[model samples]
Target: MKRAEVLVALGLLVVALVVLSQAIHLGPGWGEDGPRAGFFPFWLAVVLGVSSLWVLVQALRAPGGAGARPFFPVGGRRLVLTVFLPMAGAIALLEVVGFYIASLIYLVIYIRLTGRQGWPLTLAVGVLFPLITFFIFERWFLILLPKGLFGERLLPF
Candidate 1:
């Protein structure tokens, strides 16, 4: 358990560090009017990285030796695969259909299948969430998001 915990902590630390670096590159500083796009996330990444480092240190300094058990127990495979496959598909779809459409489809499928929700709520979330996101990010913030091939054909503005 100790070894596994240490390894996981190390992995998290590395990931947090990478995110922090990217966030810094994205412009972590505040502007004249307000914070830059990356400022909040950059600080969050810093906190995450520091916390991960602390976890790693604790894991390494623990008194007992590493545990014998495996990271994932039996029957965990299905759960892992269920989430992994959808996320992988969504990432692939991101390039093809862009974030909004891909996210809409992903949310609908996940909610309908895994959550076992009714049509009304599922449809509402599937449609409205991305639509609201489009308005908030594109229209209000003026942050032009990635519009894939279909967006070129369908969306005029």
Candidate 2:
């Protein structure tokens, strides 16, 4: 577990450094219009780098460093896979069915199977969630979300 934590922290630190470098190239300062393109990314990367560094230091400095503790206890891997597989499927479905439809399908399956909820509540959430998201993002915000191949034809507005 300690080894895993250290490795993950190091990996994240590297990713943060890479993003920070790119952000610097893009200009992290504010311009006449407003904040530059890299402002948010730069700040976020700095935060991530600092947090990861702290984690790495803690993991290294802990007593009995590199302890023999298992990364996951019994049944933990199964629980993780149950959630992870569905999310991965949803991400895979994004380009094909678009965000709203994919999220609806993902939520319905996840809520029904993993959560073991009643059909009424599951169905209600499955249908209404997407509709609400559509209204919020598309109608109110005027932000165009990917409609996918069939979504463009299926959606009336």
Name the top TM-score candidate.
2
Q: How accurate is candidate 1 locally (lDDT)?
A: 0.85
Question: Stretches of candidate 1 above 4 Å error?
Answer: 1-67
- Write model 2 residue lDDT over 1-157, tens digit each, in one string: 8888899999999999999999999999998899999999999999999999999999998665445677888789999999889989998887788888888999999999999999999999999999998899899999888877777766667
RMSD of each: 8.8, 6.0
**Which segments of candidate 2 are over 4 A away from where they belong?**
2-67
Q: What is the C-alpha lDDT of each candidate?
A: 0.85, 0.91
lDDT of 1 by residue, 1-157 (tens): 7778898998988888888888888889988898888898898888888998999898788765345565567778788988999999988887788878888999999999978999999999999998999999988998977777775555666
* For model 1, the run of ten residues with the poorest summed lDDT: 63-72
Q: Assess the local accuracy of residue 136 in candidate 1 as a C-alpha lDDT between 0 and 100.
A: 99
Considering every candidate listed, which one attains the maximal lDDT? 2
